[model samples]
Target chain A: MTYTAWILLTASLVGLSCGIIGVFLILRRMAMMADAISHTVLLGIVTAYLITRELSGVHMLVGAIIAGLLTAVLVQWFHSRGVQQDASIGVVFTTLFAIGVILIATQVGNVHLDVQHALMGEITFLPWNTIHLPVIGDIPKATLMLIVVFLVVLAFIIAFYKEWKITTFDAGLAASLGIPVVLMHYVFMTLVSITTVASFDAVGAIMVVAMLITPAAAAYLWTDRLSVMLVLSGAFGVISAIGGYYLAVWIDTSISGSMAFSTGILFLVSFIFSPNHGLMSRVVKPYTTTE
Target chain B: MSVLAVRDLSASYHKNKVLYDVDFEINQGSLTGIVGPNGAGKSTLLKVMLDLHPKLSGSVVFFGKNLSQTKTRIGYVPQRGSVDWDFPTNALDVVLMGLYGKIGWFKWPSKKDKALAMASLEKMGMADYANRQISQLSGGQQQRVFLARALVQDADLYFMDEPLVGVDAATESAIMETLKQLKENGKTVMVVHHDLLTVEEYFDHVMLLNKTIVKHGRTDETFTKENVQATYGGALRWMKEA
Candidate 1:
């Protein structure tokens, strides 16, 4: 496969995984929490690097997941202590992300990690960091990690489909039915953390937030069924990845930024033109009415 | 047989006590109405019994066992407005959630589960709205859909939080009819109700509450004007004149 193909594949896989989890976040009205987790994960990455004296992908992922879970726990604790939901998220993520930024700025100088790569990402250079495998010979390490994360997320959703559905829709009901709703919630947050950490190097925090929310939001506008919405969001994510790759190549811009931009565009299209709930359909309904 | 027993139950939210040493026993195969004023902790009582709220001091037992041990025999219908109606789901899908516990982990809803959901929808007069998105349904229809979900549970004990609020007259009658059928099937139901006029008509038993149980017995014996005045306090004068 060409280098560009590998990059596009990595982008698509990231989108697919992020998109699936994004639907649940949107449904639970925690899309901003995704943004919060992605930002706070930088703290985890830097802390791991500081401790291990290495910048391996596995170490960074572990660090980021821990940081993400901490963010969720702190937010919940604040909310329980009478702080508002958005306020708790805002306070936690900003403080942690600020610490992460300061650490990278002052301590990680001369290392391969830098502020620019942390913020904007370096998807173009992903193919250069290849890992040799038994059968595939060599593949980008990001692609392999993303594939594993994607499979894990897929298995989780399938295994706990009903639990997630009931919990997202009505947590009180889920609890009354003995579904262990709180445990399911933590498990879900852990998956979201994993997805955010895996997408760190490829899409960066900004695009991770974008992919984790926009496509799912777009799918929401198109369908009133959770199953269909999940499928549509996955499709929208892959389409945006492919479309964004070409658009980036054409315009000579950041691939992740272009992909995130495409997701926003797709969401706008759905907002305007969705069959049942779109603005256009509502506006045209009165004129089309014959009764 | 007692389906539920609550002893010395007390609960608070943010340091403000809501329920104070509440005690009640609900017998099997009876429809009981929990009635009280706006801040009288009627809903809090149900929540406390279900262990959904933090109890300052209490013990709730279900059929001689703890809640966790007897959860499969219990069903819940939350308030109509508590859920997001715009959630991306049809009525049938919401109804199918009743079987999630019975279906257990790592499994999908079987055909039998879907059929039971459909039958429950039909029982609540919501069969026509099975595929309709929940947000598009009328307020009364939405309430019926929730009722159907509870029906599909086939539980021995059901706790419904204001199932009749904001619903149409037909829907109210439909819900009452279903509750009657549940009673006929030897199932126990406790409803948090607001309409004082329908207490005698709807429930065989009534528990008037005001931070505690003021009266609890057969509706004919306990749902008197004095008990209501004690339950509602200043609010009962207007009710009396009406």
Candidate 2:
């Protein structure tokens, strides 16, 4: 209805999709790979924009998925060749991101591609880029794209929940059960790429990284059940998005940055105050038991 | 008929050869123990056989078919420590994974699967702890949980890597009893074991390995001190003298 509502809805959906996928990456110990995909997908976006001379979502999605898959492949290639995993991810992402930055500066300068906005998004301006449909005329394109991505991600999670759980927990056993672990891995990376692309305009690269990891990490501190953790992570992400929107409105700052800050705060609270695994529980257990 | 047949299986890690031309055939309904010293390729041989690791040269058949064709009939219990215990799942959830293959794609486990998993956990004395977070379990309890998971597979053949390592006496005996039960059901089981003293006591068939098969036959005939020395090499020659 309202512009602010649209922006907030898009932000919340972005956070929700990222947070859901973040749970798997966090469990698989591939949070760094998420970071890698978010950064490297920039190269794909820049490449697509340069060639098409249009900021079309389809081109961006295709390019981002390709680049993201390449990053995963190269990282695995390096790892298989004896390079350490984190190091491989570090090398691939930084190199591709650097190339993206250079391309943006030199080649895409004529386009309306602001480097600052690419790193830290301008969520306030998201409502300006609107698309008209039959009855629901004048909807923000970013909102529509993120809503679609969110639903697709949710469907993927529901359909493959068992496979994801098995593969993330024990890949060797998953393979032994004929679970096609490598195919699942690639599909997961592709989803990560899609989410990063969808959220790029709303949260930018840096904040996407925060949204992808922080809420899920916070949920992890709160629960030991995967099902509960997924629901809690989604709730945390939405809370961060809506709360950050108001905080941004009050402080007159970047909405994405404020949202990311809120996620960080939630994670810190969970880290200290979670009933089971928190630092406060650890510290209070001995005194309570003695008393 | 042999439940498992490995013909001239060779495997390497990086450039270093781990398993040399290893040949072995395991009969159906037998409990076999693979014993060797560290770096003797006991684990590698099993991994290579299951095609978990790439083989330099090998052909392994299970029940007259390739692994892919016979995967549904095979169950695996990886080393207890190999997985992340902090994973956000309870013992029951982990055990339920064994039923995923049978349940097939795009379908959730039904009440029957849960009941089956519960029964397997009960067999391992882990029924009461099914809902406990895996990370909170003791080392022995964790091992039992994994054993229960493998048991839920209801496989015709099972491969377990060091399932008894770090387990308590009670857990160890429970696992041994379960293995005996599996054999009684006419299921084939191959385990990578470390304890020399329990080799004869645990397995009906024993294969001593050191980059290759040094001795393999019925446990009573092949598990002599000399075979143990040969498997362990000069580092453990005192075993033979003793």
Candidate 3:
């Protein structure tokens, strides 16, 4: 496939993965954790490169996961200790992200490490270093990695759907019934970490939050069932991805930002127009009659 | 034999202690009503027994085993307001959570589990509203859904916090019927009840508490005007008498 084709395929995969996983994150009320993880992951990657003297994807993956877990732990610890969760997440992640920016600026002198690229990816150039497999032909390595991450995330959700549902809905009741609510919560945080790490290279940090939360929130507007919400969110994300790429090319804008902007627009539309529990429904309720 | 035993059970919210070294024992098949004024730690004590709250120093034994060890044998129904009713799950979904503990992790509820949950909901007269979203349910129906969730545990012991708080007369009767059935089936039930009038009618045993146990015994012996005065205040005693 051509370079443009490769970028398109990879972007689509990333969108699908983010949407599927984002549904649960939103339902669990940990949407902000995605934003937190994406920010802190820059530090993980930079720190790992400093220690290992290599920029291998695996090293960055390990670093990002560790950093994500640490962020989640700090957030929960602060919450348990009576600190407001949003404040703790904001403080912890901003400090880590600042440290990363300093490291890149000071040490990585040969590399062009701009904040713009760190925040939003340059997807147009990603197809230049495509890797070829025997049966699969030439493929964007990042796309393949994203596919694996997607499969892992889907497996975890499908396997532990009941546990996740129960714990998110009523944790105290689940714990009393011996469901190991804490363990399940940690496992969920780990999954979010993995998802954040998997997508950071392609979508970057700022847009990654959009991919994690926008589709999920949009899906939330459309459905009451968790299963339906998951499927709908994934579909919405893919549509946003394809549409955003073309819009970016037409408008001569950044692909990542365009994609996030499109996703955000969809969220706003859903917020206003959704039939059940939408802002528009509430506004129009007094004038409407129910049969 | 004591079906449930609590020793040196103390609990606190942040810095302020709510339950201090309070201890109690409950026998099998007993309908025990934990009656107390507001802020008397009745709910906290139940939370302690269910290990929902952190304990400063305590141990709870159930059916000759530690409470932790016997978790599967206990059902817990927290207060109606304890949950976010705006959640998107349906009534049946809530009840199916009871089977999650038994099914363990990475496993979905099976056909057999659904049948069991449905049966429990039927017992609570809520089978027809199985697919109804929790937010749409009335206050009494909401309470019934929570009770049905506990009932699906099929536990040997049940801990219910204000199961009758906002329940209608019919829902209350339905809940009382389930509680009576549980007692008949050799299950011990500890209820945190607020209504003073129904204490004698429903409970076989009563524990009057005001941060500490003022009196505990059979309903006829312990739930007297004097115990009410000691536990709550003189006003409650006068109200009970008049």
Candidate 4:
């Protein structure tokens, strides 16, 4: 496969996984919280690497999950203590992310990760880091990780469609009917952690936020059905990846940055042009039939 | 004969005591109205019994067993404003959520489930609006959808929070008719109601509560003006006559 194909594949998977979970995050008004989880997992990764002095996948995964959940808990704790919820989210992520930056700057000497790499991501060079597995032969390491997370997300959506739907829609009814509301919440946070860390290597910390929320928000304006929203958001993710790849090549710049930019463009277009819920539609309401 | 029983049930929100040592019970085939002032613990009491809120120290028995043991025979219509109406789903889909407990969790809804949901929507006179986005529905329509969702549960006991608030007269009558039908069918329903004028007419049993159970019994016997003044303190003026 061509390097371009591999890059698009990696970026697209990031788009797909982040887009789906991001839908729930957007609907639940947890988009900011999801961003906070993504950034704090950086601290978890840095803490793991600082202690072990080795870039082990398991350590990073464990550290990221812990950090993600910790971020959620601390935010909830502060909110309960009378702090505004968004302010708590901002305070928690910024503090942890700063500590991670300080640790990486002062202590880490041999590690390949830097603050820039953690934030902006380096998707342009992901194609060459290929690993030879027995069954799959040679596949890019980032691509393989992306595939695993994507499948995990897909399987979760498939298996718990009703559970996820009910819980997100109304926790009280879900709880009354004997659904494990707390368990469902934590499990979803764990998925956000895994997806955030998984996309970390490809889209960086910041663009992953863009990838997660932008496509989902755009899709939300178009459809009034959750099922349709999911599918459309996935398609928007692909559009961002493929279009952003071409844009990145044309400008000779950051692929992740271009992809994130494309998401914003898509969202802007949708916000202005969405038939039922867009700005243009409201303006044209008197002239057009809304059926 | 008791459908639900609460003993020494106390619950608090943070440092504030929301419900203090409340105790009550209801028999089968009863439609009980829980009436209280604005800050009264009427909603919290229902929440704690359903285990949606944590009880400080209490025992709540449903159908001679705990809530978990008898969950399938329970239905809840939480407040109409409890969920985001812009949730990208239609009325039929929302109604189908009631059947999830019966659908047995993690299992896809078959055509039978779809038909059940459709029938529930029809019962609420919302069959024409079944496919409409919930966000576009009127306040009364939204309440009807929520009731339809609870109706599909077919539970023996139902707990509805403020079902009449902000609803039109038509929806209010529809909801009252359904509530009466539930009682006629031997289903027990407890509603957190705010209006006091309709107390005697709408309910057979009334539980007047503030932070505690001030009075509880048959409406004619328990819903006296003296009992309501004691429960609401000076916070409530004269209730408006319908």
Q: Give the alpha-carbon lDDT of every model.
A: 0.91, 0.91, 0.85, 0.90
Tell me how candidate 2 scores on lDDT. Answer: 0.91
lDDT per residue (tens digit) for residues B41-147 in model 1: 98888788887888999799999999999988999999988889999999999999988999998889989999999999999998999999999899999999999
The candidate, 1 or 4, that scores higher on lDDT is: 1
- lDDT per residue for candidate 3 within B1-242, as digits (tens), equals 69988888888886688888688899999999999999999999988878778888888889989877899899999899988786778899889988888987666789999999999889899999999878889999999999999998989999999999988999999899889999999999999999999999999999998887888889999988878888988656455546
- For model 1 chain A, give the 10-residue run with minimal summed lDDT: A282-291
- Candidate 4: list runs displaced more than 4 Å: A285-291, B239-242
- The native-contact fraction of candidate 2 is 0.79
Quote model 4's TM-score.
0.97
Task: Estimate, for each residue in A83-179, the C-alpha lDDT of model 4 and write its tens digit.
Answer: 9999999999999999989988988866788999999888877888888899768888888878988898899988999999999999999999998
Task: Give per-residue CA lDDT, model 2, range A1-291, as digits (tens).
Answer: 888788879988987998899999899999999999999999999999988898877888999999999999999999988899999999999999999999999898777676787889778888998888898788888888898889989999999999999999998889999999999999999999999999999999889999999999999999989999999998899999999999998998879989999999999999999988899998878656511
The DockQ-derived docking category for candidate 4 is medium
- Give each prediction's root-mean-square deviation over alpha carbons: 1.6, 1.7, 2.3, 1.6
User: TM-score of model 2 relative to the true fold?
Assistant: 0.97
Query: Clashing pairs in model 4?
Result: none
Fnat values, one per model, are 0.83, 0.79, 0.62, 0.83
Model 2: per-residue Cα lDDT at residue A6 = 88
Which residue pairs in candidate 2 have backbone atoms (N, alpha carbon, C) closer than 3 angstroms, thus clashing? none
TM-score of 3: 0.94
Query: What lDDT is reached at residue B57 by model 4?
Result: 91
lDDT of 1 by residue, A29-148 (tens): 999899999998899999999999898878987998899899999999999888999999999999999999999999887888876777778799999899999988899988888998
